[model samples]
Structures are given as C-alpha cells and as structure tokens.
Target chain A: MTTTEPGTAEEPGRAGPSRTQRLVMGGAVLLTVLLVGVIIGMLVRLPGQPPAPPAYDSVDVGFAQDMSIHHTQAVQMAAWERDHTTDPVLRLLATDIEDTQHGQVGRMLGWLELWGAPTMPLSGRYMTWMADAPGHDHREPGSSEPGVTQMPGMATAEELRRLRESTGPEMDVLWLQLMLRHHEGGAPMLAYAADHAQTPQVRNLAAQMLAAQTAESEYLRELLAQRGGTPLPL
Target chain B: MASGKTSKAARRNTPAPLKKNSFPWGTVTAVVVLVAMIAVIGTYVAVRSNEQQARAEALAPFTPTAQNPDPSRAIPGIVIKEYPGGSHVGPDEQVAYTESPPFGGTHDQVWAACNGVVYDTPVRSENLVHSLEHGAVWIAYHPDRVSGEALETLKSKVTVPYTVMSPYPDLDRPISLQSWGHQLKLDDANDPRIDQFIAALRLNPNTHPEPNASCQETTLFDQHNPPPYQPAPTPGTPGARAEDESVDPSRPMQTG
Candidate 1:
C-alpha cells in the first residue's frame, strides 16, 4: 500500500491532465476572459464620462426633425388665417396656433442645432425613425415617386389655392376643417415621441404637445361644428 | 481485495495511458474563444467606422471652411454675385437687375412672408429679393413647365422653414434656386443640386447680410394679398433703381 500511494501520485504528475482537470482549466480561462470583457465594457460606460450626444439616427433627433417640418405647415396655415380671417373666434384660434407652433418650431430647431443634426432630414424622408414604433407605418403608400408622398393631413397645393381664393364665411369654415384635421393627424406622432424619445426634454416637449393638441382639437371640433363645417378625412 | 490491488498496480505502472486518448480540447476551446473575441471587436470597429464615413460624406460638401468661405461654390453651374445688402427701395419702384430673378439688390421695404410659404401665384421680385436678404431661399419654378410630379418634387424641398416657392412667369429655366448672393438654374425639378443649394446656403450667415432676421412678416406685409410681379424696369427708365446703384443713406434701412 505504501508503494501504490507514491506510484499513484507520481503518475498523475507525469501524465496529461484527466478529463475533470481539463474542464476546470477551461472554466478558469473562460472566467478570466469574461471578467476582462466586463471590465472593458464598464470602462466604456463609466458615469464620469460626459454624456454622449444623440446619434444622427437617435429617436430624439428624428422626432425633432420630423415635428419641425410638420409644425412649419401648421404655422403657415395659421399665419394666413390670423391675417385674413374676419371672424373674431376664428382669428383668435388662428393666432394661438400661429404663436404656439411658431415658438415650438424655434425650440425644436434649436435642439437640432445643438445636436449637430441637419435641420432637414438627410434622407429627405419623413417618419422613417418610427419604423419600430407600434402601429406606425413609415412607408409611403402606393407611390414610389420620391416627393409625391406627403405627411398626414398636409394640404395639397390645390386645396391651399382654393383656401387663398375663398373669402368671408367660406374661408373660416375651410381653415377650421383643415386645421382640425392637421391636429388630429399629428397626434399619433406626438404620442410615439413622448413614449420613445431618449432625452427627457424631448419626451416632455412631446407630452406637452400631445396634451395641447388634444385640447385644441376639442376646441377645433366645437368651432367647426358651430360653423356647420365637416372635418376633412384623414 | 487481491484483484483491486493488482489493478491499481497495473494503472500506476503504465505512464501516460490516457495521453493517447486526450483530444487537446483545451487548445481548441482557447482558439475558439480567441477567434470570437477578435470577431466581436473587429465587427464593432468596422460598423463604427462605416457610420462615421457616411456622415462625413453627407456633410463634407456643405460644411464651410476658412479656405472655402462659401461652400456653395462647389455646386455645379451656380452663379455668385457681389450684391450689397440693406439696399431698400419703395414698393412702387423697380430694380433694373442684371439677372431675370435678381438674387440680391435694392429691394422693397417689405419682405415676402417666407416661413415655408408656397405661393400659388407669382410674387413680386422686389419683395422676394428682400426675403433673400433675410437669409431665405427662394425656389421659383415656371408654372407651365413644372406641374404634376415635377411640381410636387419642388414643393417637397420647400417644406422646411426659411424656404419659399412660387411660380416665376416666363422663366427661362424650369426651376431656379436663389439665396442671398447665389443662384442655380435647373431644367428639372428633381435635379439633386436643388437640395444641395438649400443645404449649403439657406440661412447661412456667411452668405447673407441679415443672419437672424425674422422670416415671419408680422406687420408691414400681407402674404395673402401680396404685390403682383411686374417686368423689371428698363435700364434707364425714370425713377428705376439700377442694380449697381448705391443705397440712399438718408432713408432708414428696412430690416426683415
């Protein structure tokens, strides 16, 4: 038994590792690699680093770009109405929309400038950033032609021409109809941004826009109904 | 007990009996781990480099530098002129401009409301030129030549603020883009240079006299009933402001 004990110990020392021993060594290597990887990742994301600016394709940048374009048209329509409409109520509503949306445009444009993103979309496409958003379709419908696809609730050139030519009660009704639909169409975008934007300021702005547009929509509906004008189809 | 002792003695005597059966599993695992790590890091670096390359390519031509004060100079067939700013003319007067749609010169006291405005009818050149002084891009298209899909294409680019589009009656070209001191005429509305012009010069402080002037026309001008376009006054016509004529120092400069 004394000779067997020495032989067994000496054999293990001379021979290659056994299966269990090999497994332990492999596990040790794996653990070392994993620890190194974790350290590198932690260093990259260290809180001491200044926060990274939003990437070009980030949700915050996309929302600001798309919403700025959307609000421009609204401001244009409102500005026209504010100048031309004779009805006191319609004029008041138009003024509010003009002032609020114009200011909002300035704010969004300022954010985009700060983010170092183009004021216009680089792709010249709208709503592309909402591809993964639930219930939102960013694809242009039916027409593959580059510029034919417009955002929801945008007035056609013909419709705008008609509005420009119309006077008195006709102009009032048309403005309400158009603006009401514009508010409704933009609601979904505001909601999506509110939930998905990476920056808190963007999310807060989107939430505020959603709430204000919702309230304005109600007022628009009431005003349109009083004027016996039907809302435009979305 | 005797058989167990015999087996233990045989196992001890045969040195490296399991060595022949060993498959070098550790070496294989190490190689695989090393290769995976390289692939992960390599892929990440490649993707990041590609993104940076694409962004650089997109903005390179438009970004201004000290050597190239005006980046729009790279655009093909663009016309650059040196027109002094803050030259104001009365609404009733006309500027005898060298270019058909003058890029810059003496202009009306009032500027066209150019906050993404699309005027169905042709707007007066005097007022439109005033907008150009305020760092707005004017997209003037021939009404007859640009219709259907072509018209839509031009309108899409004007949706951003600091842009305005309207019909230019009897335009020599189908489309013409104008910033303060620049102009590019194109036969097709879908021409890529249309966007390039806008991206380079719209609201560019280096290109325009008034950098932060408001595009919104609060009081002086009426956008809905804007002044109608008329032919540029004949060069020596009475009371016409010549393109190179100096501004009247006594008159107050009109700020957009």
Candidate 2:
C-alpha cells in the first residue's frame, strides 16, 4: 500500500504542466513576438531617419515648380539686358538678376530630381497650388484653355521683341518698366510660399527671395524715376 | 504518512473543482489582444498598398517603356520618324529634308534660343532643327492659318526651359509640334494631343539625341534677330550635303 501510494503521488507531480499553465505560457510567447515586432516598426519610423519625400501636390513641390519657371524668364531678360545695356547701373543690376535667378533655378531643379517629381509642372499650368489661398485666383482673365493660363507679369512676345529691337534710352526705360512690374507680380507668390511651404529649405529659399526682391524693387523704382519712366501695370 | 497523502489529494481536488467553476478570464483576455494586434497590422498593410497603387496608376501612362518607346505614340495623329543627330549644315547651306519644318537631320551649327521663347518672325529651319537635337519642342504655325485668339492660345502653350514657338512659312499644317524625330500636326490649338505631345517628348532622354545639350543660346545665334527661314535647297544642289555624314539612326549622339 505504501509503495503504491508513493508511486501515485510521484506520477501526478512529474506530469508536464496543468492545462491552465500551458495556455498562459503560449500566450506569453505570442505577446513577446508582437512586442518585438512593434518595437522594430517604431524604430523604422523614428524621426532620426530620413523623412519621406514631399508629396507631388505638396506646397513645397508646387512652389518649386512654379518659381523655377518664373525665375527662368527673369534670367532670360536679365541676361539679354546684361549683354546689351550701356548704362553701368542697369548692367550691374541685370548681371545680378541673371546670376542669382539662374542659380536658384538650378537649386529647385535639383530638389525636384531628388524627389522624383517632374521639373515642369505636370498639369502644364502655373500657380495652381495657390488657388486655396485667401483672395487668390490662379486663372488669368478670359483664359478659356485648361492648361494655357499665362503667368502674371510675363512680357508678351511683342514687348520682348520691342525690348530687343530698341536701343539707347528707350531700351533702358522699357527694361526697367518691365522688370519692375515683373518683381511686383512675383512678390505675392514668394510671400505665400514663405509662409506656407512644408519643407524648411523651401521656406527659407522663398523668404530669401522675398527679401532680395523687396530690396531690388526699391532700387528699380529709384532707377525708373531717374530715367523718367513709369512702372508697367501688373 | 497515509493521512498526509490523503490531505494533499483532497487539497488538489478541491482547487480543480473551483477553477472549473470560475470563468477563464485570462485566456479570454489573451485571445482578444491577439485578435486586435492582427487587425491593426492588417489595416496598416491595406492602407499602404492602396496609396502605392494610386501613385502607380497616375504615372504609368506617361512612363516610357522599351516596347512603348514613346508614350505619345498612343495619341492619335502623332507622326513618329527615325532621324540621325549631330550632323551640322553651314549657315548658308540647307538640307533637302524629307519633312517640311523638319524635325531632325543636318541642322545649323547654332541652335536658336529656345527657353520658352515665342518668336514673332519665322526662325530658320536649320537652327530650329538644332534646337530639336537639344530636346526642345518647336511649335510651328503657318502665320496665315493661325491668328488672333488662336495665336494667343497657341503662344500660351509654350513653357520655359525647353519650348519654342515660331511662325513656319509655307507649313502644310496649321500647327506642327516637332521634337527630335517626333512630330504631331494639329488643326486646332485646343487639341489635347498638343499637351500630350509636349509632355511625352520635351527633354525625353529616349527620344532626343542630346539629352544633356543646353537649350540656352551659348553661341552667336541672336534670339531677337534669329536667322530667317529659307526653303530647303532642291535635290542635287551643290554644297547642300557637303558636311553631312552618314550617322547611324539607331545610335544616340555623344554628349560633348
């Protein structure tokens, strides 16, 4: 009886685990696996990691695309005036505009390339991103075509032709008139981008453009007054 | 010892009955947590895939492929040709080009200033062809055929850095868009294909000979007073093909 009793007691003690113990162990293992997975996911998304690229329709991208095109025209006109102007003051100003605007264009294009975005506006329209801003209309008056809205303050083919063909005082006065209006037109775009762009670099660039253009506008106004020329209506 | 054994057995049996009567709250909690985790992960995966699909769908039509070498080919009425690049003709000479307002072949040494310029006068075909080599889209309109609001509508399509618009005298079509070896002739400025043509071929590395070539005028070719357009010289004209070389149509020009 004694040997049988001892054997029975040992059998129950040696049995692996109770049903409840097995269930709890299995649950612990699964919980550990999930916890590890979540930790890894968090690490991957850490702020120290490189941020995701800007979205295609993001303010940073749209501003860069539109501003690059705007700067291109400014560079073109400045380059021409730089080469053709006899007045030292106008020549200096033209050179400055050409060099600065061209460099800005290169910077914007580089960003677009890195972001895998099209350098040209995908919609083939200008300033569409600014439509949501208060008191802004991105469309030109009577522009019926979907993708052919002319950017504000752009010199017409006739005006550019006249600037190219004119000489002496007439050329200088016309150039100042056109460029002053161009700067005035571009100021609002810069201000909007400066205030609302998502990327820090883009915002800084826009802010810099506003400051430089503001100073340049003052100079242009003085030069126009000296030349007895009035600014063109925007 | 027997009494002790009996007491231990009685204690184990007592707890077993109590455990069975009580609800298995721990097991229920574990199952619920596991189900919630799976649900969260599944939702995250689904959202990520949907976003990727939308982006792919947006870009697929415009993306170039080996089979569909030029995406613009899908547009109705687009004319595709194969032309050799880097062949230069002198300022005074001209190529007996197969196509009028030629898209490619034996261009002038200097490329007309593109960079979104809209020339009021007709620009030289040879120079504009050189611009094509540099990946510029030349929008040519017959002065008599397109005017007034139509002309203004056309001019607005020209965008900076790689687009040019000019009058092409004696153009067979009202509007012709030339980009390297590609051409799309259109009757209406409002045609959607015009935008499609520009989006597909302007600076398209696959379509143009010189992908790195500049659109800016680096040489003495004046933008305001660019060379006037002249008729292609008649076949067998002396010095017409003097500097022309046999370029491989399949090969892209080497960037200098």
Name every residue pair that clashes in candidate 2: none
Q: What does candidate 1's lDDT look like per residue over B135-206, in tens digits?
A: 899999998888999998888777666899999996898999999989999998778888778877886657
lDDT, candidate 1, at B107: 86
Tens digits of per-residue lDDT, candidate 2, A1-234, equal 843443242344544645556777687777859765984795477777877768777778888888888887788788878878899999999999988988997798667656655667756677877877877756666875432356777787689779888989899999999898888888988998999888889999999999999999999999999999988899
- List model 1 lDDT by residue over A40-155, tens digit each: 88448777776765767778887887887788778878877888888998889898998898789788867765655666674667777777765676666675533223677777
TM-score of 1: 0.68
Q: Where is model 1 more than 4 Å wrong at Cα?
A: A1-50, A122-124, A143-148, B1-54, B58-70, B82-84, B113-123, B141-162, B165-175, B186-190, B209-228, B234-237, B242-256
Q: Can you give the lDDT of residue B131 in candidate 1? A: 94
Query: Where does model 2 exceed 4 Å of error?
Result: A1-14, A17-44, A122-125, A135-148, B1-47, B59-87, B96-101, B118-122, B141-153, B159-161, B167-175, B185-190, B203-219, B222-225, B230-238, B241-256
